[model samples]
Target: MTRVVLALDSFKGSITASAAAEAVRDGWLSQRAGDDVVLRPMADGGEGTLDAFAAAIAGARRRPVTVTGPDDAATDAAWLLLPDGTGVVELSSTSGIEVLGGQLRPWDAGTVGFGEAIAAALAGGAQRLVLGIGSSASTDGGVGALTALGARFADADGAPVAPGLRGVASAASVDLAGLRALPPGGALVLSDVSNPLCGPRGAAAVFGPQKGLDAAGVVAADAALARLAALVADAAGPAHPGPATPGAGAAGGTGFALLAWGAALVPGSAEVAELIGLDAAVAGADLVITGEGSYDDQSAAGKVPAFVAQAAAAAGVATALVAGRIAADADVSAFTAARSLTDLAGSAEASLADPARWLRAAGTALSRTV
Candidate 1:
């Protein structure tokens, strides 16, 4: 009776983490019904952060709210409230690029919806906040979100600026006096990025293009972020190290705004893992399997699979890997058996078209090897 633990993250647009775990579990059980299999869905503060919490935490309630989306359209989103009074808000579900429906509004997309969700969570009696700032749709220095939280951004004449980067570029002053206070337990910012708010390695330069910003737009947005950071410094009375702080550029400057609101930055996967008690789960397992949408050099950089493998290694448990696609350059030395859904399906399109089926096949193959 072998104890095998499955900790897999969402396959991005393919499948949810919980569903992937169940599919793999089913296949593993089909091959070895006597083995003890545990399903532990994982996420790194991205599209499936809420799902991960929903599956792992008991008494987690989904609180729904409607707000302005990236394209300035009405969006319905939900936040998670845990039994321990922590409000988990994922930016991807509210203001992520996916909400644009394949349309690109680089100049006008904003994050007002993300902030509204956080506000809703706080108003729902949450004592703490765990904000997952990933998959953002805009690069407005997070001013749009700040605006929804009662922070006013105005021009030289005291009139509200335009929405999105257009408005951020012309903003002359900021008022945080009306901004909501932090919860009793404060807020924690989760992100996989470490870029600052501006300059070469910053948000606008590194991530702006992915959100549809052109080369010229990236330059303009970087300047606007600098301008906003300056305004924030003036309003907060200096000593505000948010602009240049690592991860400050996350979710298009949402991290910087949250930092101004007194939130501490932490690695997303590690924090989520701790929240889900992954260490204990891996420690008792005879074998562990973990994976993500893509396994590459970046996967080792605080991603879910790497985090799980590290925990399993600490417990002296053998670990296997499964991924949608394993890049040629990816170092899979830590995994005893590495399998790729793309390879199993013989084509990337086939694997993505039916991820669950390939995931089950991967699971069965791993069970056979074990």
Candidate 2:
């Protein structure tokens, strides 16, 4: 009997990692009932990081908290508390772009909610922090989050700065004295990005357009972030080079803020894979199947499929691929068998409309090859 390990990331808007794994498992089992199959849902510290942890870790509790949203409204969000006292906080849950719906508030959206959630997790006696900073909604240089964490930002007149980028632009002073201390185990930032806090390759220049910033707005946002960096250096000390650190620009500069708070940045996929014991699973399996929503050029760079495939290769196990859409430029040579749900459904729309169904079909087809 062939032992197959299924490690699939979320199919973006189509399906959750857990659901996708189950659907594929069902289909694979239908074809090879005697085969051993294992499900290990994967994430790259994006929108599905929390769900991935909850699915992989037994006895992980969801601690709910209400905090300020990107749009300055109260929003209910939850963080995962593992049995080992590691609190997994996903920025997307609290200050994600989705929370803004279609109302893009590039200048006004901030990450206050994300920080509040982190504070809540710390207050809950978390010994460690796994901060997932992805799908952010703001370009406030993380001032909002810092403010929520007890770091104060005041205007020249000593009044509290307004929320969002406006606050960042107006802030003349920062005080980290009141900021909460890191947990006993310290904080690790989960991010796949490598952009710096300011400049052309930075957060505002490259990511602001997607968050609804116009050309002028992007320029203005970059300036605001630069100012924040200066303030952070001043308050945290000249040796604090958080702004220039790779991944500091992730989650709309939340990474930088976390760095200021003494968090270390690490590759999201690798750290998560290690935590979920992916290497052990791959080593024991005959073949491993992994995938994502779109297997494109970017997939090779710390994405779930690439990370899984690399692990599988190191163990001398064959690999297969199942994805929503396989881009023409995507190199899929790592997988012995590759299937695209879009192709299986005959169109992207149909595949997206019913991802699970197509995913099951893809699973069955791959099983046939096996």
Candidate 3:
């Protein structure tokens, strides 16, 4: 190989995109030392988003900020400050479900931490904001985050609403008197999922179950979001913008909040890819490799691997995929080759137990084949 590009997405509970790329590079070079390897870690605006930016950009600093977690507890979180003054805030870092450690907060989890980190980035002089909204733990319609930014969610009695969905349910009026103005360069929302904010395909009805809500819980949360929507419409002016828009349901309605705040919504994978110069890299590469934790029907829906494969194909470059598992329905016919950790490691348990080891095994096998 004259040149090989390794652009892998994160392995969920396992290795990061960058780590997997490095492991693959090490394995590939062990067999073909003459080849040049370029690493491009990728994410679909989710948890590993900051890592992707840090890996691709020179002088992108990881700014650490202490913030409140979903459970109202203090936690350590960090956001990326790109060289061009873009503040990249990832929801999963501070307000994601994993922060609960397998426990369910349901209506109790909130995005105050996410807002605090963004506030820190803004304070540090971010020219623009790029919010990656995914892996959220709450269904507060982003009231908590907006509150941290200066809007107040008050109940019918004029008392400040409590955190999480409790606040959402009690919300009767919104106060934007003290809400901070957007930065001069504005904000952008990054999201892959396109569920709307209310109804059968809405945030609460579709995502509530995954966050531990039962049937009744889902209904109540949906009602609260509806109430919040009304409040947003009355207070937000301009006819409530994106309440029904695709991706408005992201991060448990945090995307809706960003939209209400005048942020532009864009496909997370494509936006991140452009910012990281993925198209240029693919144009120059002899071969391209991409992967994820699982390659299923969802992979075709703007996931990192699919997006990377599309980019590579557009550039007339050969592409391959590696994953922990690949579904029969996964449409990978466009790729030159595909490998899985399960087949390479001989078992699912083995692959899960040690993904890097299995990934490296697959990488070595891949090097010989290519």
TM-score leader? 1
Clashes of each: 0, 0, 0
Task: Tally clashes: model 3.
Answer: 0
RMSD of each: 2.4, 2.5, 2.5
**Residue 156 miss distance in model 1 (angstroms):** 5.3
Where does model 3 exceed 4 Å of error? 327-336, 346-349, 368-370
Q: What tens digits encode model 1's per-residue C-alpha lDDT throughout 174-260?
A: 998898999999999888677799999788898898788999999999999999999998887765775999889888888898888
lDDT of 3: 0.86
lDDT of 2 at 356: 91
Order of candidate numbers by lDDT, starting with the best: 2, 1, 3
Q: What is the lDDT of residue 18 in candidate 2?
A: 86
- Give per-residue CA lDDT, model 2, range 259-353, as digits (tens): 88888999898987987899988889998999989888757756789889989999999989999999999999898999999899999999999
**Descending-TM-score candidate ranking:** 1, 2, 3
Better of 1 and 2 by TM-score: 1
lDDT of each: 0.88, 0.89, 0.86
